[model samples]
Target: MRKIVHIDMDAFYASVEQRDDPSLRGRPVVVAWRGKRSVVCAASYEARRFGVRSAMPAITAERLCPEAVFVPPDFGRYKAVSRQVREIFLRHTDLVEPLSLDEAYLDVTRNKTGLPTATRVAKTIRQQIRDETQLNASAGVAPAKFLAKIASDWKKPNGLFVIQPHEVLDFLAPLSVARIPGVGKVMEAKLARYGIRSVGDLRSWDIFELERRFGRYGLRLHELAHGIDHSEVKPDRPVQSISAEDTFDIDRFRDELGPAIRQLAEKAWQATRKTERLARTVVLKLKTDQFKIYTRSITPGDSINNVDEVSALALLLLQRVELPADTRYRLVGVGLSNFYEPGQLGGQTELFGNEF
Candidate 1:
């Protein structure tokens, strides 16, 4: 069994705000744009106590905690801190897979420091992060990625937990089905209809029966109920897509997206050029104020030429949105995908072109 560790920074954006501004310490802090359509980026534990949360509208958050201090997100500073934390992880193991700016998975089964166990590595890394950045990180050590991810979140705000191979089943049993990753509100409701409320309940059902109901996911459910996950901590995965997006301070009508689309396309074009890979497709994405998502993609007859083309294509796709008249959107995004390394660019795949 491999020894995996999941490290998650606690209330990352909000914590950084509090750390930088001592006055915000121990007070409800929300990182968000201040407007009717703006959504919370991160909420401190103090803010969460008043029901404020990430993605909640700023208006709702204001109603929840009138005294909550709001600060705009500073991604540049967060990315810098993330790099420092990653350097600390590299001291122990090279098998690091970052999930976001605030969390990552490390396969420390064979660590460079010659640590006797994964728990020691987790503790040492957490302490180093605290000492270097003055921020708290929680850790979870387990034999598999799934278990490690769950264990890391078991305790929050400077806590650590472990899940031994022998205790896997015992640890998974009796827990709510929602504890499983990917079991969102919709999936939980679907499982509830079949009287499956816990991991134990899931295990009691026949594997074939699960497959019959949930298809491929049902087999995954059976394995997870028994605490089995074979996925590895993949490091240095190739870039499959490059994207940039913006959320408007106020919801926008269809006619208002041209400028945003052009801006995002320029941002995406610049971002993609920084990589060794070239894009073969363009994608347009939009999200309504009600959270409805829509994506339109085109592979085109050839690879993208410039930002102007991307803007034109994105605008064309915008016209294809089949929503009702006068529908409003809160977010717009543009991206490039179907990437091929520069060395692989001149290939027969260009003749037929790929469809996204």
Candidate 2:
């Protein structure tokens, strides 16, 4: 069985802030901008007790924890610390796949550190991170990436959990279907309607029945219910997509999205310059005041050339919105996807002229 380790930094951003400022150590700390349009980037353990969470509106966080100390994000500092922790992981294994600045998956089936077990490698890495960065990390060791990820979150915040190959089924049995990776509230609700509440319940269904109900995803659920995940930890995975989004201080109507779309498109375009790949799709995303999300995208015959091209395409997508005329949106986003090497794109003419 392959050995995988998933390491997750504990409240990484808030922890860094707390570590640097001793006065903020015991107090509730929230890393976010101060505005209705802003979202919480991170919350300390103290803040979390008051129902504060990342991605929630900053205003809501403030309401939930009136005493919470809000601090703006310092991405430069966070990235530096992440690099330090990455170096620690490299000492034991080269098969590291970073999920974000604060979490990663490492395949330690054949570690360079000569560790006796994957658990040993994980412990050493966590300790090294704590010693060097003065930050706590939680780790999970398992035979598969998905299980390792789940185990990493079980005890959370400077914790460690292990799932041996033989213990996979028993470990996952009583857990809620929501614990499976990629199974969100929608999927959970769907499964619940079918009387499938726990992993064990899901295990009772055959792959044929699942596939008939959930299509290809049903087949995936069958495997996960049986504690099977064959995906590997790939280092330096290529960028699949890049996007920028902004929540408005007040809800806006469809016609008012032109400026926001252009601005976000410009932001996404600037970010794309950092990568060598070309983007073939322009996407426009909107979230209604009721929290429903919609996306419209177009892939021209040729790769998008410049910010203006993306901005124009994104703005054009505004007409594609089929929401009620009185509908208002709380958020808007612009994105570029379908990344390809320059060699993969041919010299084809633009397929759709901007007929707007």
Best by lDDT: 2
Clashes of each: 0, 0
Model 1: how far residue 101 lies from native, Å: 0.6
Q: What TM-score does model 2 achieve against the real structure?
A: 0.78
Error of 1 at 95 (Å): 0.2
lDDT of 2 by residue, 81-164 (tens): 877887788888878887667888899998897878988888898889889999999999899899999989889889999998
Q: What TM-score, to 2 decimals, does candidate 1 have?
A: 0.75
**Candidate 2 at 186: error in angstroms?**
1.4
Using Cα atoms with residue i matched to residue i, what is each candidate's TM-score against the true structure? 0.75, 0.78
